[model samples]
Structure formats: C-alpha cells, structure tokens
Target: MSKYHSFNSEKNIKYKLPNEITLFWNKGLFDSFIGIDKVNIHYAQFIQEQVECPTIVIVPGRCESYLKYQELSFDLYQQGYNIFIIDHRGQGLSGRMLLNVNKGYVTKFQDYVDDLRYFIENIVTPKSSEKPYLLAHSMGGTIATRFMQDSPNAIKAAVISSPMLGFYSGLLPKSIAKILVAIKLKFNNIISNTPWYFLGQKDYSPVNFTDNKLTHSIPRYQYFVDLYKKNKIIQLGGVTTHWLAQSIAAQKELFSKIVQLKTPILLLQASGDTVVCQQAQDDFCQQLHTLQPQSCPNGVPSNIDNAFHELFFETDDLRNKAITQSLAWFEQHT
Candidate 1:
C-alpha cells in the first residue's frame, strides 16, 4: 500500500462563487479521508433514487479537483446515474507535497493506479450497490488508460475524453529527455517549469464561466487561485523531469500492451485539441484495430470535430455532441 498523509490544519479556507453562477442544489456532502498512503482523498456524492443504477466515477484532468466537476455530476445525475468523483492525490484538496517537492508530481504512474484502486474498493463500490463505469478527461484519461491496462476487469466500461496518449508539443528524442530527467530526479526528485502562463491571465480568470465559457464555473477554481496566490505550493507547472521520464516509460508500456486489454473502451478524440498530438490518438486506435479487430469492426476511428481538448466542456453545441455520443456509446455497451 502507498503512504497516506493527514492534514490537521484548521485554516479557514473559504470559497466564493461568482454572483452570476447558480447553485446546483442536490443532497450532497463534501467528504474526505486518508487513502493509499493516507493522502487526503476528497470527494463529493449526489444521491437520489436508491435503485441499482450504474455508478459513474469521474477522474478529472491535472490541476482539477472534484469540486471543479460539480456541473458534470449534475448532468450525470439527471441521466439517472449515481455520481462519484475524486481529487487525485497531488491535485485538488488532497495531500500536498508528498515528497520534499511541489504538489502534482508522482514518481510512478502506478501511484495513481494504486490511489484509484483504493478509491474504488473503499469508496465507490461500498457506497451504492451498482456496477461502476469510468469517465476521465485529459491527464485523468492517461491515468484511466494506465488503470485499464493493469485491471481490465475493474470497470464495466470507460470513456476517455481527449486522452493524453501524447502531448502536442513537438517530440524530443526520447533518450535525451529521459537522460535529463534521470539526472534531475537523482538530486531534487521534483522539478517544474514555470506555471502554464495562460493560467494567470486576467481575461482567463478561472471563475469566469458564463454560457460562452470554455469550462464549467466552480467556486473551487477561485479558491484554488487564492490558494496558489498565497501558498504557491498548489500551482502545478509543466511535467517535471522525473515525471517526464516515468510518463514516457508508462506511455510506451501502455501503447505496446493496450491491445491486450479486453475492457470495453470509448476513445473520444477532440479535433481542435491543441494539447495532445492527433497522431498519438491515431496510433492508439490503429493498435487496437490490429489487436482487437472485433472492437473496431468498421475499420474506422470514432472521432468528434469542432472541439478543443476539453470536449465535454467546449462550446454548448460541441459539449452536447460529446455528451450525446459518449452516453450513447455507454448505453450500447452497458
């Protein structure tokens, strides 16, 4: 089992939602507990009818927490699926600075798998008597893909939104990048580039989610902004050298073996995404075709256009299309 940390601080952290935003009213609670190395895993639950409906566990992207997904949960609830979401170990209100390094850096990709296993066995399964499905976005999609590789039987199905099979940045020679990260990890264990510059823009305030917004409006975004302002520890910059080394290693392993995974999967690619390379998605689907020919009988890829990386949160029309296609796929397989 991985080590978990306990946060005993009593700081009065408050979240202020924008006045223009309307509250999502439902019977729910903000909960946390130590899991997978005692990291404070934070989550929220919305319970409605007690029928044995399917449970959908949503894993968010990097720098995102469960609170940031409240709007998505509301939609799932309306679809009659019980909803549960987690703030991955390094992100959200989970444990901070697990090592002597900044938050959001994990030495091994399997650390996330372990954390998700703990969450599934301890939280999602016990809470409601229902089969579980997974929906992951961005970095969350990477984590979900890794999890499916190891434990294909764990979930009924998985929907990956703009999965980060690879980043959009032009490739570096893998050998050179690995050497640099290995050298840095030996000394510091954690390294970060400057915070993604777009995160700090005034016009791009995290809390500004009107109907035309790129993402959902969550009070926690403003809270995190303030948290980053004061503490500076919560800001997740680009991947570290150690992170890069481990991630590249993991991606290689996943791509080489993903064809063996029998777990049903729905890969939702975003045509307008500028973060992950389209070639990676193409390569992954092709590999699946070679290995699991029955899975892609049409010999064609499934894709959606006119959307950015966060397809589910793109413009209203695109977002609806993503949701419609995803839920339709899930329904077909479930």
Candidate 2:
C-alpha cells in the first residue's frame, strides 16, 4: 500500500482553499467517435503537499459540469486524495452538439466512454498517481460502469452513487418507454443525431425546492440552482430521445459485463432515491457476488438509508457519511 497521509477532519473541517489545492484545465481533445469531431473537455485537479497521493477522478452526471463539484473536490482533497474532475463533451464549457445548447445530446453511449477514455489516456493517467479511484454519480455512474467493463484497469476502485443502471421512467413502464423510443429512432431522420426532446421535457427550467428530489439541504440545493441561473454555459436541460435510447442500451451492456469486471466497484445506493431504479442495483450487485464470490462475498452495494439521489449533493450529515464510507471502501480495495 502507498503511504497515504490521512487528513485530520476535526482540524480541516473549515473549508479553506489551501495553497496545496491548485486547479488546472485541459482543452482541444480531438475525438474521432462520430465523423472526426474535435470535442473540447475541461478538467481540474487539486494537488496536495505529498510527493505521491492517491487520486480520485470526479465524473459529473447529466446536465452537470465540473463547476458544481468544487466543494466535493475540496473535501476529498482534505481527505488526502488528489482530485481530477472533467466536464464531458456536450456539457460544461465543452462544445454543444445542437443549436439548442440545453438539449442533452450524444451520438451514442460509446461516444461518452470514448471521450472519457481520451481524457484519461491523454490527460489524467499521465500525471495522476499509479492507482486512481472513480467517483461518479447518476448518468456519470452509468458511463463509468461501461468504462470499467471495457477498461477494468482504469481505476483501482469506483464509487457509483445512485447509478443510472436503469432510470426511473416516472409513470411509464421501463420496457414500454424503451420500445417507444426505439420506434421513434427509426422514422426520425435526426432521431439518432440531432433530435426532438423527450416527452414533457424542454430547455432549462429551474425546479422549485418543493418538487426537488436532490437534497434535503435548502442551501445546497439553491446553490446549484443559483449556479445554473448564473452560468448558462454550464446549464444543460432535459434529455433528447437519442440520449435516452443510448442510455438505455449502454445500461443493458453494462449489467451484461458487470460480473466480468475485476475492479472493486461499490454501488452507493440511496434508500430514498426516486431518480434511479434500486431493484436494478440489487440485481446487479447480487449477480456480481454470485459470479465473483471471492472479491464480492456479500456484494459491493452499500445502502445509505437517509440519503437521496444525489448523495454528494445532499445535506452535510448525509454527504459526510457517504464520503466517509466511499473513502473507506476505496482504501480497503487499495
């Protein structure tokens, strides 16, 4: 094990941007995923005083950018881990796919994995520690799981928070929604590329706190809302039909290869999460245990009872518990 100097939480609890925490960005990532597009991805890192530190790469969810993960990055930095956060293509300050920048769009699910791989291979892996962990949430978790299945050695461990292994389709059944989407993809010329929005979905509209399912803390929730209200460049709205179909298919591919993954992946399931399907998580973790009994004796998913969909974005107490458990799980695997 590497000599990781743990942070003194009591002393370092007051969130200060210490000199050790430095930020950097990378641009002009040329991606050949769809017709040789040059997609720019921005990334930031927090360095500590140590010569070699354990690293954690933060992959933000749908409609999210690295800007929102500043607090989480700082907290992780205080915990003796260097942080690397990236805003994937189409989100954040990266190039948008369509005229309506708010529309969540992707050529295919693999396009995301390709872009992530580009960031890792060209940017992160070169400067990061020998062993790095992935901390991904929601849609980000879905992407990460696919990445792990394809490239198992990319990270030492992964904390998949409220993973979109299968998304909650509100009033509609999952199978029915998927079938409708599949049919819509055929006749629509721009369906797979630049397409119409999902039903009842549109450009960015701020959701009121009363209807919010993210966090229990008002200040934190408002902080994110205010962020989007201020920086429209990072404000991504509802999903497009192309994105939904790709997400559904990618999730199917991920679970198919879940048992083959060698890296330690912890499915951080939230008991109160209404955004994702908990039953899917249960099924995936159970299969992992059955296939790899040695590595996953009791399965890797950990249920945080009081937590919501956004574990890191939740109340301070909930966030702290999730982070503590996540860090411990990573360390044990390391």
Which candidate achieves the best lDDT against the true structure?
Answer: 2
Residue pairs with backbone atoms closer than 3 Å in model 2 (clashes): none
Where model 2 places Cα greater than 4 Å from the true spot, the runs are 1-36, 190-193, 294-297
Q: Which ten residues in a row have the lowest lDDT in candidate 1?
A: 1-10
lDDT of 1 by residue, 257-315 (tens): 78657766777887767767677878877777677664433533467766667776554
Q: Compute each candidate's TM-score over C-alphas.
A: 0.76, 0.87
- The 10-residue segment with the lowest total lDDT in model 2: 27-36
User: What are the lDDT scores of the predictions, listed in order?
Assistant: 0.64, 0.76
Residue-pair clashes per prediction, in order, are: 7, 0
